[model samples]
Structures are given as structure tokens and as C-alpha cells.
Target: MNQEFKKYQAQTSPHPLGLEISHAKGSYIYDIENNAHLDFVAGVSATPLGHNHPKVIEAIKTQLNKYMHVMVYGEYVQKPAVELAKLLAENLPEPLEQTYLTNSGTEAIEGALKLAKRATGRSEIISAKNAYHGNTMGSMSVMGYEERKQAFRPLLPNVKFITFNNFEDLTNITTKTAAVILETIQGGAGFIFPQKNYLEAVRKRCNEVDALLILDEIQPGFGRTGKLFGFQHYNCIPDILVTGKALGGGMPIGAFTASKALMVLLQENPKLGHITTFGGHPVIAASALATLKEITETNLIYKTLEKEKLFRKLLVHPLIQEIRGKGLMLALIMENADITNQLILRCKDQCLILFWLLFEPKAVRITPPLTITVQEIEQGCQLILSVLNQIKS
Candidate 1:
């Protein structure tokens, strides 16, 4: 199977943590040989309720008995999709009442960019440097890292980059800007949180220019950051709020929300301006709705902070430089990339799933499932510390 995977499947990274999984539940993944691996990365922060969560699975099962994909998105009034959108609006801030669902995070990012451009009638998009929105062309164009994007050059024109959390860089967002897209808590760039008032200042500047603020909550949404959305932490609501990852509860989904007045423009001027065949698939929406209800209704969202405290309290070591980020969205900055790599690979061999940040080589990702218990936190932290000690010895 490993040989077949390497030969048949197209490779993204040269070295992939190819774990042949048999099943998963709660916070652990079982291999084909029945080795129980404690999952710390939570499928890159997608499985908030953990693997094959009963509620999410039951929702999918129930939806399957009724319908799957009746019609392409927006054509048919699917109950799951409509209800999910409505529930999202009920939870989100005002003016972000309407939602456009998509298949994945990247697709949602693309749609949000289009919406911003359509509403503002401007093409210039200001994005933060070292930011990772998504890999799609529209999202990639705004990616601040040059090396990753150099190969995909001649991307969406009029896209510019600015350093995140740098107040001076806020000036680059001018009246000509259509939207300033940013990751509320910049993932893949060491899980960097916005400095004090940085997001607020950006909101002020965008308001001044009448430019839209599109916050990408792909990694930090769905109660991962101790709030329903990461933007809520800073008290600055985005004009267009993009969300995904944990929103699906292990299912694949994405959505962009804005004012009805602003979103209705797509329906009139272009008439199906942004159309997707399987954007709001009924089964996926059902799973998402269940996931959202479980998070908002239960204490899981608030428990994230408590879990985060336990992780911080237990993960202290000399080799660890610093911890960056908030809530479950965290990165441990090792002294160097070598140490980070060693810790991740060694921990994996020890049946603990650890991962690295996309752009930050010296950082290790620690985004576990929000449903993870205190015992799981202690277990994972102990494994991490053991690996660190071995490396130090």
C-alpha cells in the first residue's frame, strides 16, 4: 500500500507521514495493525469534534437516507444548507447574515475575493506578508510568501502584500483597495496572533477607505480559538468572514458570509456570478450543522482555553523557545528547524501525531481536536516532553 501510494498518488511533500489508518475515534487514530496513535494535529485542525464523531456521523447518515446532492448550490432549497446558513447568521455579527457555501476553504476564499471585488468595484487586494489563505489562484495571489508564489507568478493582478501586525504597513491599504484579506490568527506563519489593536486599526483604515475587510478564519474558526470565530477575539468584525476547517467536523466544507445587500449583488448583476455545483451539498451541510450545534451548544468552545492552559503548563522545556498563538491554535517555536523536525518525527514514531507549520520551519503545530480531554492533553504533552528530553540528552 505504501509503495502503491508513492507510485499512484501524486505527491505534495517529498516525505509524507503516511499512516495507514484503520479507524479513529475521540482523539486517537488506529492504524491497520491496530496501533493507537494519539492525534495532536487533529487532521490539520479540521476534526474539531475528533474522528468520526457520533453527532457528525449521525447527521451524515440521516442526510444520506433522505438526499445527497439534489441540485447545484443555490438552485434548490436544501433544508440542511439553508438551516446551516441561518444558524451561522444567528451566531455571527450583523450584516454577515447571508452565506455562500463552497466545497473547501480555498474555494470559499476565491468566492469571498470575488464578492469583495464585485461590491467595491476595485481590484487591488492588500494581504499580509507570510500569510497562507489557500492554494487556489485567487487565494495564492494574495499569499505573502514570495518563494512559494514565485512559481505561480502572473497571478491575480493588482494584489499587494503588507507585513502583518505592523501598524506602519496599514497605510498601504488605500481607497483603491477592493479588500484587505487577512488570516485573523495567521496560521502556517507560526500561528501568529494579531498584536494589540492591530486588527482594530486595520478595520478603521478599511472603513476609512470604504474597502472591505475579509478575515480568513479557516484555521481558527469553529471554536478553535475559544470563540466561535477568531475575529471575535479582537472585537473587529470583518466585512466578509470566511470560515472552514473545523466547520465541517471532519467533513469537507467552506463558507463566506456578508450582508444580504452586498451578497444579493452576485444574484442580480452577473446572475449566478459565483456558481458551484456541489458547494452546498445537503449531506455536507447536515454534517456541518451538527458540528456547529455541538460546538455552540456544548462547553467545548470554552473548554479549549482550559485545555490550552494545561498544554502550556506541561510543555515547558529549555529547547522550546516560545509558544505563539491563542487557544487550541498554537505553535511551539523550537530553537531551530532541526529540533522541530526531530521532535515531530520522533513523536510520530512514538505513536503521537505531531506536525510542522507551513512557512515557519522552527515551529511545531499543536492544534488538537477541541473535544480532546484533559487526560489526552496530559498524555500528548508527556510524549512531546519525553521526545524533547531524548533529543537534548
Candidate 2:
């Protein structure tokens, strides 16, 4: 199966963690040999309720029995999709009421960028340095890291980048700018959090320049952060909010939300300005609605902080420099890139699943499922410390 995966499946990386899976339940994934590996990555924060969650699975199954894709998005009034969008509007702030669902976070980012340009009639899009929105052409064009995007040159023009948390760079956002997009918490940049009213300052600047603020909450949304959304923690709300990853429970989905007036621009002047064939698939919407309801109704969102405290309390070592981020969205910063790589590989060998960040080589990702228990947290941290101790010795 591993050989087939390598040969048949096109891979993003040369060395993939080819773990042949038999099944997964709760916080552990079982290999073909029935080896139970404790999952710390949670499919890179896509599974917030843990593996094969009953509610998500039941929602998917029920929707599958009823129907699947019947028409393109915005054409039919599917119950699951309608309810999901309405519930999102209820939870989000004012003016962020209407939503346009998409296939993934990258697609949502593309839509948001287009909306900003259409609304303001400007083409300049501003982004933060070392920030990662997604990998699609539009999102990649806004990506700050030049090394990864050099090969894919001649991307969307009129995109600029500013240093995140750097107050002085706010001058770059002028009247010519259509939008300034940023991750509420920069994910690929080692889970960096905004410092000292940085987000608020950006909001004020965008307001002053009549530019829209688009916040990409793809990695930090959906109860992974202690709050329902990371922007809630900071006092700044975005003009366009982009979300995905955990939104679909374990399924694939993404969405961009804005004011009714703003989103309506996609309909009339262009007549289906942004259309998707299967953006809001019924099965995926059902799974997402279930996930959102469970997160909001239960204490899972609150427990994320408690679990984070447990992880911090247990994972103290000399080789570990610091842990950055809030709630379940965390990154373990090792002393060097080699140590970070060694720790992740060693943990995997010890039957624990650990992963790495995209741009930060010294950072090991620790975004596990929000449903993970205290015992699971302790178990994962113990394995991490044990590996660190071995590396130290």
C-alpha cells in the first residue's frame, strides 16, 4: 500500500510519513500491524473532535442517505448548507452575516481577494511577511516567503507584503490598496501571535485608507483557539473572514463571509461572479454543521485552554526553547532546525504522531484534536519529553 501510494498518488513532498493506516479512533491511529500511534497533529488541525467522531460520522452518514451533490452552490436551498451559513452568521459579528462556501481554504482566499478588488475597484493586495494563507495561485501570490513561490512566478500582480507585528509598516497600506489579508495568528510562521494591539492598529489603518481587512482563520478557527474565532481574542474584526480546516469536522470545506451588501456584489453585476460546482456539498455541510453545533454547545472550546496548560506544564525541557501560540494551536520551538527535525522523527518512532511547520524549520507543530483528554495530553507530553531527553543526552 505504501509503495502504491508513492507510485500512484502524486505527493507534495519527497519524504512523506507513509504510515499505512488500518483505522483511527479517539486520539490514536492504528497501523496495518495494529500498532496504536497517539496522534498529536490531528491531521494538521483538520480534526478537532478527534478521529472518527460519532457526531461527525453520523451527520455524514445521515446526509449520504438523504442526498449528495444535487446542484452548484447558491442555486439550491440545501438544508445543511443553509443552516451552516445561518449558524455562522449568528456566531460571527455584525456585517459578517452572508457567506460563500468553497471547496478549501485556498479557494475561499481566492474568492475573498476577488471580492476585495471588486468592491474597492483596486488591485493592490497587502499581506504580512512570513505569513501563509494557502498554496493556490492567488493565495501563493500573497504568500510572503519568496523561496517557495519563486518557481511559480508571474502570479497575480499588485500584491505587497508587510512585516507582521511591525507597527511601522502600516504606512504601506494606502488608498490604492484593495485589501490587507493576514492570519489572525500566523500559522506557518511558527504559530506567531499578534503583539501589542498590532491587529487593532492594522484595522484602524485599513479603515483610514478605505481598504478592507481580510483575516485568514483557516488554521486557528473552529474551537482550536479558546474563542470560537481567534479575532474574538483580539479586538479587531475583518471585513472578509476566511475559515476551513476543522470547519468540516473531518471533511473538506472552506468559506468566506462578509456583509450582505459586499457578498451581493458576486451575484448581479457579473451574474454568478464566483460560482462553484460542489462548494457546499450536502455531506460535507452536514458534517460541518454537526461539528460547529458540538463545539458551541459543549465545553470542548473552553477545555482547549486547559489542555494547553497541561501540555505546557508537562513539556518542559532544556532542548525546548519555547512554546508559541494560543489554545490548541501551538508550536514547540526547538534550539535549532536539526533538533526540531530529530525530535519529530524520534517521537514518530516512539509511536506518537508529531509534525513540522512549513516555513519555520525549528518549530514542531503540536495542534492536536480539541477532544483530547488530560490523560492523552500527559501521555503525548511524556513521550515528547522522553525523546527530548534522549536527544539531550
Candidate 3:
């Protein structure tokens, strides 16, 4: 199977953590040999309620039995899609009522950028340095890391970048800028958080210039950050809010929300300015609706901060320089890139899954599912400490 994967499938990284899966349930993934590899990454923060939660599965099955995709998005009145958007509006702040769904987060980013340019009549977009939005052309154009994006050059023009959490950079977001796209909490750049009211200040600056603020809550949204959205914690709301990953439970979906007025502009001036056939697929929307209901209704969202505290308490070690991020969205900053690599690879061998952050070579990702138990937290931390001890010895 491994040989077949390498031969047939197009590879992203040269070395892939090829774990042959039998099935996954709750916090553990069993291999073909039935070795239960504890999942720490939660499919890179996509599965918030853990793998195969009953509610999400039931919703998907119910929707599948009733109907699948009958028509392209916006043409038909899909019950699941409509309900999901309505529920999302109920939870989000004002002026962020209407939603446009897409196939993936990157696609959503593309749509948001286009909407910003169209609404403001400006072509310039600004992003944060070391940020990872997505791999599509528009998202990649706003990506701050030039080394990763330079190969895919001739990207969308009039894109600029500023340092994340830097107040000085807010000045760059002037009237010429259409939108300032930023992660609610920086995900790939070691889960960096907004500092000293930086997000608030950015909101003020964008307001003064009449530029839209697009917050990419792709990784930190959907209850991972002890809030339905990470921007809630910072006391700042974006003009356009983009979400994906955990929004669909274990399924795939993405969406961007703005005022009904702003979103309607996409319809008339360009006549289907941004359209997607499978944007609001019934089955996927059902899954997302279930996921959102579970997170918002239960105490799972509130428990994330408690779980984060437990992780910090158990993960103290000499090699772990610091733990960055809030709630379950976290990164362990190691002393060096070599140590980070060693820790991740060694933990994988020991049947405890850990991963790395993009563009942050010295950081180890620890974004486990929000539904992870106290016992699971202890078990994973013990395994992490054991591996760190081995590395030290």
C-alpha cells in the first residue's frame, strides 16, 4: 500500500507520515494491524468533535438518505445549506449575516478576496508575514512566506504583507487596500496570538480607511479556541469572516460571511461573480450543521481552555522552550528544528501522533480534537514526555 501510494499519488512533501489506517474512532486511529495510534492533530484541526461522532454521522446519513446535490449553489432552496447559514448568522455578530459556501478554505479565501476588491473597488490586498491561508492562487498570493510561494509566482498582483501582531504594520492598511486578511490567531506561524490590542487597533485602522478586514478563522474557528470564533476573544470583529476545517466536522467545507448587502453585490454587478457547484452540498451542510450544534450547545467549547491548562501542566520539559497559542490550537516551540523533527518522528513511532507547523521549523503542532478527554490528555502528554526524555538521554 505504501509503495502504491508513492507510485500513484502526487506527493506534497517528500517524506509523508504514511500511517496505514484501519479505522478511526474518538481519539484513536487503529492501523491495519489494530495498533491504536492516538490522534493528536485532529486531521490538522478539521475534526473538532473527534472522529466519527454519532451526531455528525447521523446528520450526514440522514441527509444522504433524503437527497444529495440536486443543483448548483444558490439556484435551489437546499434545506441543510439554508439552515446552516441561518444558524451561523444567529451566532455571528451583526453585518455578518449572509454566507457563501465553497469546496475548501482556500476557495473561500479566493471568494473573499474577490468580494473585497469588488466592494471597495481597490485591487490591493494585505496579509500577515509567516501566515498560511491556503494553497490556491489567491490565498497563496496573500501568503507571507515568499520562499514557499515564489515557485508558484505570477500570482495575483497588488498583494502586500505585514508582520503579524505588529502595531507598526497597521499603518500599511490605508485607503488603497481593499482588505486586510489575517488569521484570528496565526495558525502556521507557531499559533501566534494577537498582542496588546493589536487586532482592535487593526480594526480601527481599517475602519478609518474604509477597508474590509477579512479574518481567516479556518484553523481556529468552530470551538477550537474556547470560543465559536477566535476573534471573539480579542474584542474585534471582521468585516468579512472566513471559516473552514472544523466547520464541517469530519467532512470538507468552507464559507465566507458578510452583510447581505455586501454579499448581494457578488450577484448583480458580475452576475454570479463567485459560483461553486458543490459549495453547499446537502450532505456536507448537514454534517456542518450537526457539528455547529454540538459545539455550541454542549460545554465542549468552554472546556478547551481547561484542557489547554492541563496540557501545559503536564508538558513541562527542558527541551520544550514554550507553548504558544490559546485553547486546543497550540504549538510546542522546541529549542531547534532538529529537536522538533526528532520529537515528532519519535512520537509517531511510539503510536502517539504529533505534527509540525508550516514555516516554523522549530515548532511542533499539538492541535488535538476538542472532544479529547482528561485521561486522553494525560496519556498523550506522558507519551510526549517519554519521547523528550529519550531525546535528552
Q: How are the candidates ranked when ordered by lDDT, highest leading?
A: 2, 3, 1
Candidate 1, residue 52: Cα displacement in angstroms equals 1.0
The better-scoring model by lDDT among 1 and 2 is 2
Q: Model 3: how large is the Cα RMSD against the reference?
A: 0.7
Per-model CA lDDT versus the true structure:
0.93, 0.94, 0.94
Top candidate by lDDT: 2
Query: What lDDT does candidate 1 reach at residue 128?
Result: 90
- State the lDDT of candidate 2 residue by residue for 274-389, as single tens digits: 99999999999999999999999999999999988888898899998999988999899999999999999988888999999999999999999999999988888988988888
Which run of 10 residues does model 2 get worst, by summed lDDT? Answer: 267-276
The segments of candidate 1 whose C-alpha lies over 4 angstroms from its true place after superposition are none
Q: What shift in Å separates residue 312 of candidate 1 from its native position after superposition? A: 0.7
Give the Å error, residue 391, model 2: 0.7
- lDDT, candidate 1, 1-393, per-residue tens: 998999999999899889998999999999999999999999999999999999899999999999888788898889999999999999998989999999999999999999999999999999998999999998899888988989977899999889998999888999999999999988978888888889999999999999999999999999998998988889699999999889888889999999999899889788999999999899999999999999999999899998888889999999999988788988999999999999999999999998988899999999999988899899999999999999999
Q: Write the per-residue lDDT of candidate 3 for residues 115-191, one digit (tens) a residue.
A: 99999999999999988899999899999899999888999989899998888888899999999999988888888
- Give the clashing residue pairs of candidate 2, or none: none
In candidate 3, stretches whose alpha carbon ends up further than 4 angstroms from where it belongs are: none
Q: What residue pairs are clashing in model 3?
A: none
Off by over 4 Å in 2: none
